[model samples]
Target: VSVCAEAFNPDDDDEEDTEPRVVYPKSDDQRARLQEACKDILLFKNLDQEQLYQILDAMFERKVEPTEHVIDQDDDGDNFYVIERGTYDIYVNKDGKPLLVGKYDNHGSFGELALMYNTPRAATIVATTEGALWGLDRGTFRRIIVKNNAKKRRTFETFIESVPLLKSLELSERMKIADVIGERSYQDNELIISQGDQADCFFIVESGEVKIMIKSKTQADQQEKTEVEIARCTKGQYFGELALVTNKPRAASAYAVGDVKCLVMDIQAFERLLGPCMDIMKRNIVNYEEQLVSLFGTSLDLENPGI
Candidate 1:
């Protein structure tokens, strides 16, 4: 069921609670199944192996009989559940009438929306058949998932704010960008993108530097193309957008200058979040072309003219 967000009120008492962490006993089979189920979840994608194991350890198993109301709409969220076996139906209370909105049977999960946003449970989940589920308590979910996600958002937001290209975006829009973008690290001299490849994503340097290069075929019969370094993108600078914006092949190759980390957003996100800045980006393309002319003196073979 679809639900909207509400302001999260962090409980002052929960902040200071020193109660020992709760860990439920699980058989080896149960642990293995939970691990497999969690592997494909977006919420757990950023978690390291150790953190993943911690989540597994904290989950308890619950067996439900047919017609059991596992979660009720409008109640405060307490546990997030991962389906292990059998079928369930999701119901939403619309205008005092219960409507069946969806169903889950496989390894699907629910109740996290409430926990993550501090809203009431928006849907009621009822067991259609006897089923088993692994549940993680509210405190554990916040400690592991909420805490790490907040830290990551703050880190990405800081780098995004430093980018001149995105300065025109509102704070809320920038925060939305931060939420969907992802991070990747590259070793020294690792190729981030190759010249002439189709552009699918844009990059923003989070740390270290990215070396920009362009390839040129000096002679008609030459089999090898000469690659020349054009620029170095330091922290907060961005690359790989020219091709994406122009809908052409990458104009230059990007390589990690050292141990480097970058924030990446796919073409879809670039168009969605940065759509308003298109005119600004188009203007900057001309400025980039001028810079290239000054650097080479003669025109380089930039079929698409981008970086």
Candidate 2:
């Protein structure tokens, strides 16, 4: 059975009614499976059980027979797919022929990038066996997922306002910076930045601590590396400002001292949203440099330790 977006979307007329609205239903096992699937997807990673349920409420079941095209390259995409039970071949065109490019089995998802940005589908996905899937449309994703992300970004914006690097920014400017920031989780002992890696992003500790390490001389060989802990970063502190201006290799490494979460912004977004702050960084660079050297030392890291 196959259906399009218009069929599963909640009726708009029910939203404003005084009566209590009943969300779409799912079985306990179905909800559990959906929640597990949502975790691997960055867009819905932060959703709580209720939010996950809301997504399930908006989604509808789809089934496909062997050799069916779930999505075709170059199509205007408005719906995202989450395969529940299936094996599939994903393809892309090369020299006017569809070339095998990827595969999707149970728990796989596709069409999300297009739904997120309303872009053309990048490849074709065809089922290799009988399959079951769930689909979410652009309207539902925008209404629920987009709004939820917006609210979360607003809270993060408020948090960044406390940083001296951005303290002077107006609420509007801070929000601009906040909107593009992405979230990542690090387990204990995970390296968040590595020494000598080209710096491309800045990070702010949102929760837990990240340890700063500097590379120092070791007994084995002058060329060999040893990490020496120098400082600890707690909530509200940000790093990598030197990279923002110098465009040099990072001088130190940072690792999650324990379970940690951070908000990150890549170089382009950093420059585009906070370009005016370059002047601020320049004036404060010396003081910030002094602080880091006094704390983390000169030789060190770029990437957070490990994946």
Candidate 3:
């Protein structure tokens, strides 16, 4: 199955509410260890506390003796395994010989590729030392992970639609943006962007407000510059596009006004997905400059673009 967001249709209903999830009760000691191990794994990072508990409950432990073959190459895979204890060697059959390619010690995960792609196991896993492994069935994994991912994509799609800067973009382009964008949260008074920093990722306010500040010279004789608030961006409003477009250092700073949440798009995604709309974005700068002139009574120097 394709892992891309678009590959999983949003219309497909999540079975989470209806399906009876399998549970393997664990002792408090076991739960603590699993929680610590899961925290370091990238696969579980996106899941919330409740979803994480569901995963922990679904996992069953398997004890293995030293030199035992845990999984054989080319065998049909049904469950994904995470190491709880001991070491294991990964061998891929190259020609007729078993080639030692990788190893997992103490904490790691495997057997996911087979379940994810619905293919035969690519390698053989042999226990190098006596250990235990946590196993999760494919059904539960897909129901929780795959379905939740689809839900997230749908949420992002809906939110991205409200961003005025992206209104002119085609539907396909907007969907691509939704796939690449990520979320970031900031506390009140937290600095989001610093003046003179190189342009990297731009942002759209998802909640609360962001204050755009610029350093301006009040007079030719002034020894120090004064930071003035230029704009306040609320939900659906975007900033930092100008510097990204001009390939210049940020000419202004931005800070969270209250508890704030933002959707972030890095420079790479901006260049790749929004590249075709460069002319449209450039034209929009005129309106931006006009707004600045009206609001601040002075315009920003385009040679050093601001957010």
Candidate 4:
């Protein structure tokens, strides 16, 4: 099935209330409660106030009685919930038996991963007491958050079109890749990738710059082994594709020159969506490595590109 937000059409013809009415939290005190309830959710933690408001505006309150199944394993995830009151029991099937694996008390959240990835519920969550919940429906979450992410991704794809190695991809092919690529940020002086490490993710700098370096022999006058810079990368530049295609160690390290943001895709994503290009690079590995060395000298030694 195509990747998108979960289907959110609730059946209205059923006699009994299968779904509860949504009540939005108003007033700063209440929204503050909603914000506090979401403190532990890493996905929502980075969201700014405006973004948080969007989600809150689209949410509704759900009242549940004791022993009610708030979510069932393998069910299509319809909503993401935050506990405003009471507790819940989380269960997952193990060896054909339902096992209680976790619990969510006041201010706990469940069903976020499903909404983020459009996957089926992995665990069942049952209300353990008469309580209330704040929920964002699938459609609303997609409209407010997922759609914004999609827009950002398209912008990144446009930027990727100018990359040296990826420039050859057809617009449609690149668009496929845009769907799976993820973003990351780094603080100034932070390490982006280390030399001699097994590389699993390829990256393209989206903003700011990173310095390329290689570990060198300890300085004669100093006891420490300092990395020497060989190249500097800026927006629209990419690295680590060599390791993705060859499954080899990184030949050089990268450290953020300042605050940096990058578009990243893991090896699996590269292979699945952009696999054909992998072989092309592998077949001409020698020439490609040489070209890179020419582009970014290794340890200030052009001959020792270190690939």
Candidate 5:
């Protein structure tokens, strides 16, 4: 019997141990950390715990390598990524050299513009170290941020509160404006409005600040130059109101002071909702008239009601 048992054992010493070994599935702690960290990100902020868990389940254990290019300038931006670990550098081509624009570390994010419109990548981003990143494609990201229940409306309202131009609007009018507005967020120094460009939309600041620069003609040989800032916009301030009323070129350029969030409404939408309402028009006219009367009294041209 001993001889037969020995013959059955391929390796005698190895077979001597009969205890079973415990095996554990990979820990979900990393995923939990990521979900918790991303809670404040633009697309994930409004999601509840249960909704966040669902998102975590769909996005676990994803990883990226050091020096990997997360995005390239001019590429079609179709994905948004959140860094769970490590760092990344944003670069732009200047004079045939890659100029470093900024660095993003843990909890940093990029690629949001893809969710709003199909715009080209504004800068190239490369992972500076081995990192874990969570990715949401354009379609999925939009479904969460723009298509989810009441999220878009709430975000638009939040944005409207930041612009000064919209400050005079009543709640009912604000809601009407919110229905047609779009929200956007940009990093520090990003250009929100370019001078001389045809203005298609008006913007309301939601968070952060912006600097305005105007183009002017100098007396020195009639040379055109940019004028110093005539206005600085902060939260609850609005710009480009004139653009919504008239399809004219932008009078000034607006650049992000830090990170900025804005609510933008196209001229067509503005005209459709707020322009035709005689009551609203009359109310605005009266408000403006009252201000003028306070400043200039009866000498002001009060006959033109639309001003």
Candidate 6:
């Protein structure tokens, strides 16, 4: 089946909702409003006009009432939401107390992580006032974003420019890196990388941003997952090098803060490219180790101990 057909007709066993609904067109006014709404959201703010339109087209319009629960904490997440109007209160149960984690206004979005990772919702999001929302389920969102090669290319180029590791690389090398990598798109609140999972590939942010969650064994009786803003990896910032280099499980979990596009480099491809420059690779690794030791008084174990 064609891509458009497949997008329009998703699941064969799904039952249609009999409730009457208002349909909005892909009109100039709607497009302009969507562009404005995207601007207020950090992730979508930087997307090109065409890309924004494509995303807007994929989403379904939703009108939520005040005090309505959009998503309850611990619920299975299947869709992501983008606020077109009004506000929401995001809360989480902490230490037996309900804590207000965040307040989201127009253009704000959430529920991406659950769709991406198949995890339960981390927080309960309730509409503070009557609102209009754009809902994009996982299937439609991925089909639109990830399968679009042209969009992926643009995202890759934008992301590569922002990565520190590739900043020193030549233009040719950057292009080559972009060519070698594969794209992955996530809805907001999705886990890009899970702590303790086997790391298979390194990632470069093409668009959007992710937050790192670190689990620390604080005391004999306490273990807590602390969310830290290690670095705001936006277009071009690369991560997962530590796992790729050491063959260790991911030390932290990275969650998408908004609609995200990333270029992932397979480990085998990375090693293959570096194979011809073994001597240069060794020198660079050694230099990096020396610099780390000088600054932090500790060195990374890059060499195989058995070898």
User: Against the hidden true structure, what lDDT does model 6 obtain?
Assistant: 0.61
- Per-residue lDDT, model 2, residue 33, is 68
Ranking by TM-score: 1, 3, 2, 4, 5, 6
Clashing pairs in 4: 22-60, 23-60, 23-61
Best by TM-score: 1
| Per-candidate count of clashing residue pairs (backbone under 3 Å) | 0, 17, 0, 3, 7, 10
lDDT, candidate 3, 230-293, per-residue tens: 7899999888888988778887899999899998876655765687767877986777789767
Error of 4 at 211 (Å): 1.8
The reply for model 3, stretches above 4 Å from the true place, is 1-148, 218-225, 290-303
- Of candidate 2, the 10-residue stretch with the lowest lDDT total is 298-307
lDDT of 1 by residue, 1-307 (tens): 4333433333332555354777888888888888777654556667788778788899988999999999999998899888888799889888899998667766567787678777788789999999888899987887777766676677677778888888999997787677557788999999999988888778989899999888764564235767878788998888888997787898889999889998887664575578877888789788778877786665566646666
Model 1 error, position 253 (Å) = 0.4
- Which of candidates 1 and 6 reaches a greater TM-score? 1
**Model 1 misplaced stretches (Cα beyond 4 Å):** 5-45, 50-147, 220-222, 295-300
lDDT of 4 by residue, 1-307 (tens): 5444435322222324333434465877777777677655434533568777667776777899999999999888889887899888889889989998656666556675566567788788999999888888976665545545555555667677877667777876676566557678999999888777876777889899988876654355125656667667799877677666655677778899889998887554565457656655665556645655574453343223333
The digit string of per-residue lDDT tens for model 5 on 261-303 reads 8866655445444554435434544554475456445313222
Against the true structure, candidate 5 has what lDDT? 0.60
Candidate 5 — which residues are off by over 4 angstroms? 1-27, 149-162, 165-307
Give the lDDT of residue 228 in candidate 4.
61
TM-score-better candidate, 2 vs 5: 2
RMSD to the hidden true structure, all candidates: 8.9, 9.5, 10.6, 10.6, 19.4, 16.2
Q: Write the per-residue lDDT of candidate 2 for residues 1-307, one digit (tens) a residue.
A: 2122323223242454242333557788877766566555545656677767667777767889999988898887767777788898878899999988556656656675455444578789999999888788777675666556676666787788887778877787786566557788999999898777877778889899999776665455347766667668889887776665676777678899889999887664565567767787676556645664575463222233211
